[model samples]
Target: MSAPEDRPLLRVVKGAPDDYQLAALTAVIAGLASVSPAEDKAARRSEWANPARRVRRPLQHGPGAWRASGFPG
Candidate 1:
């Protein structure tokens, strides 16, 4: 008997899928498997909730300090 690691990644139990259909299914599964949990969480994270936003920018101490403060870094 073949080991689990040597088994096929997918099996078509019901219908016979065409080459294109099988390729699409394989691509989708491979794409999903490539993304790590950390990357998935980062992708779902909101820009507003970013930790970088919490960190203050360096204070510009020049003539345009006040004006610069009004604009983002």
Candidate 2:
């Protein structure tokens, strides 16, 4: 079997690329390799869909009860 170092990093199947073109291609490939992948962020849960929201708040008695009911706990 051929050694790892013996294998070419890239190969030209058809068209012949100049030194500058090959250099640009190599730089692009190297840049892509160096970039870190974006983090897998956890999706935010909507407040409206929360289980706590589904549960009813305790009933308040007396003055301003109507106004309080309009507002969130």
Candidate 3:
């Protein structure tokens, strides 16, 4: 017989053993709370803001030597 390979994935097992997941979530929440509110707000804002300082390499084609800028590859 073929192995069971068609089972669907479950985001959360209902009424099942979920203590680990709950523990992990609690840990994450605790960690987040450990940070200062101002610092946390700044970090969250930065996460959405465009990154600063990027590498620019001159392209060998196009009208002028175009350059690409952004986080390092």
Q: Give the Å error, residue 10, model 1.
A: 0.8
CA lDDT of each prediction against the hidden true structure:
0.90, 0.93, 0.56
- In terms of lDDT, model 3 sits at 0.56
lDDT of 3 by residue, 1-73 (tens): 6566765323455665578977786788778879776643443454435464343454355544344223333
Q: How would you order the candidates by lDDT, starting with the best?
A: 2, 1, 3
- Model 2 residue 12 distance off true place after TM-score fit, in angstroms: 1.1
Candidate 1: tens digits of C-alpha lDDT, residues 1-73 = 9999999989999999999999999999999999877643445778898998889988899898999998987
Q: Rank the candidates by TM-score, best first.
A: 2, 1, 3
* Number of the candidate with higher lDDT, 2 or 3: 2
Off by over 4 Å in 2: 48-73
Candidate 3, which ten residues in sequence have the lowest lDDT sum?
Answer: 64-73
Clashing pairs in 1: none
Q: How large is the C-alpha RMSD of every model relative to the true structure?
A: 9.3, 4.0, 19.1
Q: Which portions of model 1 miss their true places by more than 4 Å?
A: 38-73
TM-scores for the candidates: 0.46, 0.60, 0.28
